[model samples]
Target: MTFLSGWGRTAPTPATLVAPRTAPELSALIAGASSRGLIARGLGRAYGDAAQNAGGVVVDVAGMEARWSLDPDTGVVTATAGMSLHDLMLALVPRGWFVPVTPGTRHVTLGGAVAADVHGKNHHVDSSFGAHLRSLTLVTADGTSRVLGPGDELFWATVGGMGLTGLITEVSFACVPVETSRVRVDVERTRDLDHTLEVMTATDDRYRYTVAWIDLLARGSRMGRSVLTRGDHARRDELPAGADPLAFAPSSRLPAPPWAPNGLLNGLTVRAFNEAWYAKSRERRVIQDLAPFFHPLDFVDGWNRVYGSRGFVQYQFVVPFGEEGTLRRVVSRLSAEGVVSFLTVLKRFGPGTPGMLSFPMPGWTLALDIPAGQTGLAGLLREFDEWVAGAGGRLYLAKDARMRAELLPVMYPRLAEWRKIRESVDPGEVFRSDLARRLSL
Candidate 1:
């Protein structure tokens, strides 16, 4: 038995791991799955139980040989499920093309991106990854390989279904054309929560990408103080003379220690780090490589270990535009309580995808990494969940680990529709995961 856990390194469980090199191989394995059932896994970046099967079969798609083809004229790429964005960038960036949307890290797989409908800083301008997908190939419970697109109900269901509807084998998506793999970024530090919100609300539309790193521990007048970074892809003319404008080599990663003591990221240490980080910022405009600009943490391999042996919970939720009060309340409460979140981010989301369960909506999203073992954490988060749901907001399933199943229908009104579609395609419920079982999805 192979034990597997999500990126958070929490609630690990044992399962039979299998790697199928081809679609037929995957389909055959599914047909022979035991009563425990099976689930598809790619790159294991869900941050929660979405990618785990717990005693069932885990189809590790990442082990499948990477394959992709790009059409430079249309800037669309058709790639197998196993291909990672990092690999895609290495091949496309030098050719003056870029993925339409990328999350905080490029280590995620194409199939996982579709399953999560991943979004990024540019969500205000562009939608999540699903918006760019032209079509996807899925292997259903009955071992039938089907190709689906926007016109198909099953396609929308699988887009953000967390890999429950079926196993996504391949996908074709549009790529953004770029003159350089660099971003011209503007950085500014806000004095307080109101100022931060005001600046973002006023100027976010002007930039193609924008995000704010909030210091959740900052209280009183400085509560919600943030470092705002906004930018767009740099044009070729903006580059220094003779520079390789399309250069796409990312920096090598430095590995984190194999283990860390629990509570290593206590409030004191986190507060100190937040203060230094906040103070270190100054209003400036500079050109930065795409890797550093979009995926800074990716430079530190296994940085989650810093949260220690108990692991961490990545709580990410979004509240609609008019419900800014709820957003303010949550941030204020966390700050007042001196809750230690080593990494806190706030971003504005634009229109959402058609996927029934896709997380994004037109609103403000806040993501925090808190220690799992923190006192009163569960109750506090559960309270926040009620506030979010009451405000017509919902949490991101990809990052969720400990939300109540009772609230799933409330948070996702389309849950019934999604469930109907899932049942239609997977009536036997052949596709199962710890997340599916946990939330009754």
Candidate 2:
């Protein structure tokens, strides 16, 4: 048995960890799982318990031999679900192609991406990962590997199902064509949340991608000051003279310190960082590499360790477009409570896919990283959950380490249907995780 936790480093648990090298080996394990059940894990970046199950067997697919192919003409890719976006990008970028969707980080695996139905900065233009997923190969509790397409109900179930229905072994999806590795970005500094939202709503459509880095700790007139960064893949002419626009080489990374104080990211330090960041990100336009624009934190190895041994919790929630009042109230409450969050992201989401458990909708989504040690953090967030549920909004399960089970049905009205669908394929309930057990999912 080995200990495990998600990328956020919360809710540590022990499980029998096994790596299966072949489909038959993985199938056999799933078919003979113990009462605690088993779930598949990849790259361990769900930021929560979606990949962890106490006392159960955890199957890591990294050892599973895999292969992938990319069609330059169509920008379509066929690959095993265990393949990470980092690997996929390394292969595709040089060939003038890029993943159709990417989250704040590129270390996540194809399986995790599908399970979470992740949305990126470009959600307003491209939608979540599920919208681009053409099909997937899932290994069910019955030990059957079935190919499911968009027309199949089972495919939608697996899209944002958090692996409860079964383990995903392979996936085929569409990639986007990129003329250059750099992005032409425009930066704007908003004095407050209201102005930020107004500008984003009015101008976000002009760009293919848009996101704001919020200073959640800012109070008074600047209660929610933010730096909005909007852009799309740069064109060839946008690049400087003689530059290799297709070069996929990202900047070098600096390793995080071996160890830091448990409260290293407390309010004071975080406030200073946020202040400096906002000051540095004045209104401007520039060209930046895809790496910095899409996944800046990935440049720093083991960056999560900065939160110290106790780890941190990533809270991400979305409220519908008309629920701007609720959004303002939540931000006000967070600011009033003096809760400190290092990196708070705000983005606008477009129409969503048909995935029953998918997190995003036509709304505004906010994601923040808070140290778990914050006093009364749980209760505060629970209250925010009530506000979100009341507004008919929902939280992102992939980033939720702590949320009430009762709110699941309220936030996700289709929970019962998803559960029904899950039980149909997993009659024996052979696939489970700590997240499933927590909310009785």
Candidate 3:
């Protein structure tokens, strides 16, 4: 047994870790799992305990047959779930293709992507990752592999199901064609949250991707001030002379120090960082490579260590449209509390996919990265959870580490339906995780 924790570095638990290199091996391991049950793990990018199963088994899918082949004619690619988006981008971007959806980071595996049903800055247009999936092979609790598509209820359940429905063996999806890796980005600083939302609602249709970096620690008139960056993939003609349009290379500038004292990212430091980030983007309509625009943090490997060994808590919640008041209230509360959330992002979500428990909807979603070591942090978040639930908002399961159980049904109204479908396929409930146990999912 070995200890494992999520990217947040909280709640370390010991589990029997097994890496199966082939589908058959994984199937056999699942069939012979011990009473502790099992769950699948990918790049461990989730900020919570979704991947870790205490005293249970964790089958690392990274070793699966992850080779991928693309059909340029149809823009479709098939590969095992273990393949990382980082690898996929390197291979596909150079060939004038891009993943249909990508989160802020590219280190996640295809399985994790499907399970989380992750959304990106383009969610207002492209929807979540599960929406682009053509078909997938699911290994159920009975150790049977079934090829599934959109029509199957089991398929929908597995998507955003946090891997509790089954272990994904293979995935086939459609990739979008891009002319060049460079994105023509337009950036501006918003005076406050209302102005930011107004600008996004009025003109977001002009761009394919939009995201706002919010300064949560700001108070008074600037409480929810943000920097909005919107852009779409630049055409080959937009590039300067002699530049390689399809050139794809992402280099890490440096890794975060191996260690830092807990509480390193307090109000004072995070306030300074947020101010600097906002000030540095005074220039508008800048051209940047996809890495810098979409995955800027990727430039610093192991950057999570900057939050210190205690790690941090990521609270991501969404309130549907017409609930802007609730959104404002939450922002005000966070600001009043002086919460040191360094990378709080606010975005507008579009229509959601059929993943029953998928996080996004037509709404406003805010993601906050707060230091877990902060005093009274859990209580403050719990209070916020109640407020969010009351406002008909839901939290993201992929990033949840310490949410209460009762809110699951309150937030995800389809919980009962999802459980029914999941039980039909996993009668024994062989596939489980700490998250499933915590929320009683």
lDDT, each prediction? 0.93, 0.92, 0.91
Q: Write one digit per residue (lDDT tens) for candidate 2, span 213-235.
A: 99999999999899999998999
lDDT minimum window of 10 residues, candidate 1: 19-28
**What's each prediction's TM-score?**
0.99, 0.99, 0.98
Error of 3 at 59 (Å): 0.6
Global lDDT of model 1: 0.93
- lDDT by residue (189-210, candidate 3, tens digit) is 8888888889889978889999
Which lDDT tens digits does candidate 1 get at residues 180-241? 99999999999998999999999999999999999998888888999999999999999999
Best lDDT among the predictions, by candidate number = 1
